[model samples]
Target: MLTCVTRGLFIQLVFDCRRLRKMQPQQPGYSSSRAYLELIADLPWQKVSEERELDLRAAKESLDRDHYGLTKVKQRIIEYLAVRKLKPDARGPVLCFVGPPGVGKTSLATSIAKALNRKFIRISLGGVKDEADIRGHRRTYIGSMPGRLIDGLKRVSVNNPVMLLDEIDKTGSDVRGDPASALLEVLDPEQNKTFNDHYLNVPFDLSKVVFVATANRMQPIPPALLDRMEVIELPGYTPEEKLKIAMKHLLPRVLEQHGLSSAYLQIPEAVVKLIIERYTREAGVRNLERNLAALARAAAVKVAELDSTLRLGKEMQPITTTLLDSRLADGGEVEMEVIPMGQDISNTYENPSPMIVDEAMLEKVLGPPRFDDREAADRVSSPGVSVGLVWTSFGGEVQFVEATAMAGKGDLHLTGQLGDVIKESAQLALTWVRARSADLNLSPTSDINILESRDIHIHFPAGAVPKDGPSAGVTLVTSLVSLFSNRKVRADTAMTGEMTLRGLVLPVGGVKDKVLAAHRYGIKRVILPERNLKDLAEIPAPILAGIEILLVKRIEEVLGHAFENGFPLRLHSSL
Candidate 1:
C-alpha cells in the first residue's frame, strides 16, 4: 500500500511541474525569469492616496483658480467627489464634457487631477479605429503590446490616475472591430475590476482609475458607450463670458508668452468686446486667443522698436544735440537740446501713451470681419427668402431658405444637399398649403390647379453643406406662403420649429443653441414653438433681453409673426 501511494504522488508532482512551466510568462531566449519578476514588482499599484474630505476643498480651490466660468460644471464635479467620499467602494462616474473645441474640456480633466492629488494621463481617441488600440493585441501576434488604458497606467506608475479619453466621437470603426465597443468594458465599473488584457492574459484591477471623455458632437458617439457616461454640456460662452475669459485667463497667458506686460500693452474691455463680436465668432476663445496673440505679436514688435530706438538715442545723445540745432536753424533755435528717437521735436516724450487696440486697430490686426451679418441680413430681405436657425457641431448658425415660383408641371425642386428629414419637411409644407388653399385664399382656382400651373424651386443658400432636421418645417412653410402670396418675410425675424400635416407646431431640440444663433445674427424677433418657451430659461439673460421671442402653437401664428403684414388673403364670394 505505501509503495502504491508513493508512485501516485510522484506522478502528480510531474504533472504539476508541466502545468507551472506552461503558465510561466513567455520571454526572449537567454532572458532570466528574474527580469520578468522585477518588471512585475516595478509595476505601480497605489500611487495616489485614498480620497479624503480635505481633498474636496482643495479640488474646488484648484478648479476655480485654473478655470473661469463653468460654475455648474464645477458644482457637479464637487458633488461627484462628495459622493465618492461617502461611497468608497463605488467607482467614479465617467464624466464626458460635450462642447466645441478649445473650451477647456481637456484642461478641466487636468484640473480635476490636481484637485484630487492624482497623476493625469490623456489618450486621444480621434481617428482610433482598431479594437486592439483599446483592449490590446494578443501576444501571439508580432509587435504585440498592451492597450492605451494599460499603457497609460504603466506610464503613470499607478493603478489609479485620472485618464482623459479625448475626442471620443471622432473614433472610427472598420473590419478590425470597434474601439468604442472595447471601451464599454473598460469604462464599465463592474467589468473593469477584472479587466483582462490580451497580452497580459491576467486580470488587472482598473476599478480605481478615473476616466473622463470629451467630444464636440454627441450624435457621433456610440449610444452604448455614451450610456456609461454622465454627460455634462459646456455651451459656447456668451459675449460677456467670453470677455471675462479673455481678461481673466487668455489675456495674461498671451501677454506673458509674447514677453510683454499689461503696463506696456493695454487692451481695454471695449477692444476685447469688439474682437469678440467681429474678428472671432466662435463658441470658445481659441480664435480669440489667436487674435490676441497676433495683437500681442504686433505690440511686441512696436515695443522692441521703441526699446531699440531708446538704446540708439542714448548712444547718440551728443550727436542728437548737434542734429537738433541744425534742424531747428530754420525755426530760430532758442537752445541746443537732445531728444530721444521715440519722441519728435515736441516735449511729449516724457509720458508716452499706451498703444490702444480700438476698432481701427482690430481691423488692421485681423483685417475685415470674417463674418458679416449685414450681408446675411440683406439676403433675406426679398420675398420667398426666410431666415432659419440651425445648430451645428461648431455652434449655432443662421441658414437662409429661399424659394421661387416659375411656370412648369408643378414639380418641387430642392437644391440643397438636404437629408431625408428636411426633404420630407418641405413636402409636408407644400401638402399643408395645398390642403388649406381655400382658407389661405392662395388663389381663385383650386389648390391643385395653382400648384400644377407653376413649378416651385426651393434652395438652401449653402448647397455644399448637408442640411437636415425637421426643425425648419415652420420656416419652410412660411417661405412657401411668402412666395405664393407675394409678401416679404420680416427681415428681422428668424424661426425654428417642427410642423405637422395638421399645421400644429411642435417643439424641437437645441432651443438654446438656436436662440443663440439668432442672437448672433442680430435677429430682433424670434418665432419658437410654445413648448420651447421653457427652454428659454436656460438661455443667458442678456441674450434673451435683446430679442423678442414670440411663442406660437400653430403654423398660422408663425406666419403672423414671420411676415410684416401676416399672410395676404383674397376675399371669396362665399365669405
Candidate 2:
C-alpha cells in the first residue's frame, strides 16, 4: 500500500513537469513554471558534502592558529566537535557568538567549517526585514524564489555544508514580516528536521547541516530564537591580547596582503603598543589592524620606490662608465638597458634598507594620536567632575559627569542625552545629598539652606550620544557631593555602581568591561561595589596588576577613594 502511494506521488510530479515543459513561451504561467522547476532541480536534495573524520586535537590547533586567546570559546567548539565525533548523528545546540564587531566571530565560524571539512556558506541577515528572506516567497507571487537558506545550499551544491547566518540580531519585524520569526523554524532542532519553504512547498532535512550565527548584541535577538542556540559571550580583547594578535595574526597577514615582508618593514613591539594605545581605542583589534595595515601600505610604497631606484641604478651600472659617460661628455642622450626578469636583482643596491617604524613614522602615516590616556585626568581636574565607568554597545567607556551650582529654584538640571533611569538616579542623588546636608557640611554657615540657596546642573560630556542605566547612581552621588562640598574627585579614580537613598552602594552589571575601560583610560584606581569583587576574577591578571581596585559597601567609601581628602560625614542620628 505504501509503495503504491509513493509511485502515485512520483507519477503526478513527473506529469506536472511534462505539462509545464510542453507549455508555449507565450503561455501565462510558462516563465514562473520554468523558474519553479529550475529551483526544484537545482536544490541539493541528495547531494551532501563528505565531511572529514573529526579530530579534536587538530580542530583545536586550527582554531588557535587562526585566532588568538579565546580559551573558553575554543573549548566550547572542541566540545561540540567531540560530541559529533562520538555520535555523528547527535543533535547539538547551535552556536551563537555574541560580541562586539571585529572580534573574529565570522572568522571563527569559517575555522569551524575548515575543521569539519565541509563547504562553507555565509547568508547575511543584517537588514533582512521580510519573512520571505528566511522562508521563500509563495509560488503565487510573480517573482517568487527560495529563501536565503535554500539558495545558499543550492549555491554551495551541498546539503550538509556549514552555513553561517551573519548578523542575525540585525533582523527586524515590519509589515512585510519578521525574518527572526521565520528563523525560529530554521534554527530549532526538532522543527528544522522538516523545514519548509513557501516556494519549495516541500520538507527539507536540515539536521545534517551545521548552523552557526554571529551577533553584535544578544538583547536585540528574540528570546525564543536566542534560546535555541548555545550562547557564547566573546568579550573585548585586552591590550596584551590585542598586542599578541597584532604581532602573530594581523601583522603577518597585513604584510602579505600589501606585498611586503618584515625585512622590508619592521614594526617593533613598542611601536605596536603605541598604535594600540594612541591611535585606536576599541574593544576589538579591528581598528588596530587597520592602523597596522596603513603602516604596511606606507612601507609598501617606500619599498616600491626603492626598488625602482635600485632597478634604474642597476640598469645604469652597466653603462655608467662607457655609454653614459661618453654620451654625457658628447652632450648626447643615453638610454639605460632594462634589467631582465630572473636576473639576480639581489646584487642591485643591496636590497634597499628596511624601514623601521618609529614614533615619527606613526605620526606621518596614521596622523596624530586619536586618543590620549590623560583625557580622564584632564577632565576630572576641577570639583564636581567625577569619572564614571559605563558600558555601551561599543564596550566599556569612561564617562565624566560634571555638576555645578547656580542660584535658582532648587531643581536639578541634567544633560548629555540621559535616559529615564539615569535621570531618576540623578534625582535620587540630589535628594540623598539634601537629606544629609548637615553631615556633609554643605555650607560654612549652619543657618543657611544650601538647597534653597542654589540650583544644581549636571552634565555628562559627549552630549550627542545617549547615556543611561542605574550604574551611574554612585557616580551621580559622587559628582553631587563634590559640587556641594567644593572638593575634587581624584583624577586617577573612576567608579560604577547603583545607589539607594539610604547611601548603600549596590552592585551592577558589566563589571569586567567597566574595569577594562578604566584601565584603557590610564585610571590607576577603580571603585566598584564590594559585592562585585567576584567579577574581578574574570579580569586578566596583568590588567588588575596595573590598577588598584577598591571595593565599597557604602557610597562614603567611594568618596573616600574618589577624593584626596576623605569626605568626613559625621552622623548625628542613630535611626
Clashing pairs in 2: none
Could you tell me which residue pairs clash in candidate 1?
A: none
What lDDT score goes with residue 376 in model 1?
Answer: 57
Error of 2 at 521 (Å): 0.9
TM-score of 1: 0.84
lDDT by residue for model 1 (217-246), tens = 898898999999999988777788889999
Candidate 1 ranges with C-alpha deviation above 4 Å: 1-42, 49-52, 55-58, 308-353, 445-447, 568-575
lDDT scores of the candidates, listed in order: 0.82, 0.87
Q: What is the TM-score of each candidate against the true structure?
A: 0.84, 0.90
1-575 per-residue lDDT for model 2 (tens digits): 12322466457667769999799999998998888777777778778778879988989999998989889899999999999899988888899998878889999999989988999999999999999998999989888888989899889988898899999989988899999988889988889888988988767888889999999878789999999998998888899999999999899999999999978999999999999999887788889989999999998888888878877876774324676677799999767698788898567468767789999989999999889977887888889999999987677889999999999988789999999999999999888777777667785544457779678999999999999899999898899899888898898999999999898999997887788888888999999999999899889999999999999998878887888968786766321
Q: Candidate 2 deviates by what RMSD? A: 4.5
Q: Which candidate leads the pack in lDDT?
A: 2
